[model samples]
Target: MFAPRVALASLSGESDADWAKACEHPAGAAFLGGVALDEPTREAARAMVDRDRDEFLPEDPVEFVDDQLSALDDAFLRAGVNVRTVDLDPLREVTEVCASHDAVLEVNAHCRQDEMCAAGAGESLLRDTARLCEQVETASDAGAAISVKVRAELPDVHLPTLAQAVERAGADAIHVDAMDSRRVVRDVSDATDLFVVANNGVRTREDVFEYLSYGADAVSVGRPSRDPEKVRAVYAAVKEWFL
Candidate 1:
């Protein structure tokens, strides 16, 4: 019921003010993402974000990440950010935890973090299809809108299979990371049936519109603060740009 025409460029670290701004895009209906994970610099990052939005610590992602992700999901949803959840084993813990908090869950296969992948998360899902599908069904059964975040690189990445599998898994949407290129989007279109929420490297309204041209349901903001003063400025400009 939100911006079927426009969406924001979302990422790991975002603010409620960011969500407020992204939604103001006359074209934007809602935002995606549940703030950033506990990065290597949690304290420093925490200071940069609004106190209410989820922020993580600087350490090897431990089981503690599961609770952090759950807490973030709950916090953002209450703040009205349409928070999307991510965790180590989206199948093992994130799905249920997100559902408990009434938040959306995504299988984050697009994470490029080396430490994440080494721990059997992130892009690791792309390696074993059999396991991935099982996990997809698991998340889908939990009542969370399942999504798969991928680079949308073809030949190099099996986005089509991943997309179909995600759909079969009962996902409500697919979050495509286009890496600032339209070709990447075409690849995702070829794979899934669910609506698209385009992401990654978006710096302008034109890029947002470009995704709309390809049937993307919405876009996410990569770097806009939820600060009251600046957030609305960016949202207002984008609103005018698309309308």
Candidate 2:
């Protein structure tokens, strides 16, 4: 899991510069991006892919991904912070790159974009729990520390059941974007031994503490991460709590 308890959540357009900046912060870990693994996956993310999107990695997806991951590994090596990459792709493709780079492989099931859903990749996977579990198992079998990121409020998606499925599939962690429902985090935590990461709207020490108190092993910051001060505040809050 992470130390300090605060993680920089996967932002759409996070750049190398963004990674560098986050490296200097006190957050326990930095999730690089929800990048696309192939042309199809990239196409599925088209609507959200802007110049700022992490999907803008390289012209050749695999090479570019490998290179970027290596760069992150180098950059964060001395910082003692974990580098995790989130991506939308088949399990095989994702596990290959993550294994090569020695980075954590997080499956992206939290995105609700229409394009992604149409591709049967993002939130669409929620309705297909079997597929999601398969992805986690595939990644885990490939020697990667697997993280399954899911949205808590998806229709008909039972948070605890999904968490148990992910755990049974060998996922090392469950990243929950628990929108307004701390109960989702609590339920998932109670259902499995997987490291629980609570995400969304976490801006202050109080927010971090609230999630942790609800059984999250770590808390993540998303939109608020655009501001370095907020990231710092979150880091300080986590640090203070640990002290």
Candidate 3:
């Protein structure tokens, strides 16, 4: 529900308050850390780091979220956090912090890391729709405008159906990583009323237009988010097209 309708998707270890501030201008929404909340998820994050993968493993995750949002007190764009955890208990507290900051708590069902899946987080949630919806409902009940980050093209996972289940579970938005199967954006868009934010390979204005044409309410820039020029170009594309 942002003006230009472009979002900065969360990067594993890189996305934080400073990162959000740096890229906040042109984009309408910026999602912060894919922070690992519970112990299992945090331990998996450590394993990822051992493999040279980036991750956010703060000692006090709920407090970390508070500090991150507090640092962005003056930012004009909406801010959110993409969180991962195996247990549902932590979401309530973390989401409360998100609500206090007027931010969205994005449940991460999109991550594909083997470690994350083994911890029963990330893409594993895709295979377990019930658990994913429960996570959504947990955050939603905590007074958060919750969003669920989901990826398409996973085996046996019908995104449209998953989208419907989440919508029924009180999610406000669906951040779809339309990996390879771009039409999944349209399918999910067609199936539900959730605000759809399409992601993946979004580098140019044309890419922005492509996702918009597929019925995406907004398009997110992932890898090139650090490239201000590219993010600006995509933002300009959305502004120009929407205007």
Sequence-dependent TM-score of model 3: 0.98
Candidate 1, 1-243: lDDT as tens digits: 234244444455443334434345343333344333333223324543554444443343323434444444523222122221233243445456556655455565665554445544456667766556666677778665566666655355667677777777676677787774666566677566777777765456566557766766656555643433343444454466557
- The order by descending TM-score is 3, 2, 1
Each prediction's Cα lDDT score? 0.52, 0.71, 0.92
Local error of candidate 2 at residue 23 (angstroms): 4.3
Candidates 1 and 3, the one with greater TM-score? 3
Candidate 3 Cα outliers beyond 4 Å, as residue runs: none
**Candidate 1: residue 144 lDDT (0-100):** 57
Q: In terms of TM-score, which candidate is strongest?
A: 3
**TM-score of decoy 2:** 0.87
Residue 156 displacement (Å), model 3 = 0.4
Write the number of the candidate with greater lDDT, choosing between 2 and 3: 3
* Best-performing candidate as measured by lDDT: 3
Query: How large an RMSD does model 2 have?
Result: 3.5
lDDT (10s digit) by residue, model 2, range 1-243: 656677777766564435645544566666666666655566765655552334553566556556666666654421111222224244566577777766677888777777767777778888888888877887788776778888887769998998899899998888899987877898899889999989988986788888888898888777776777887888787777767
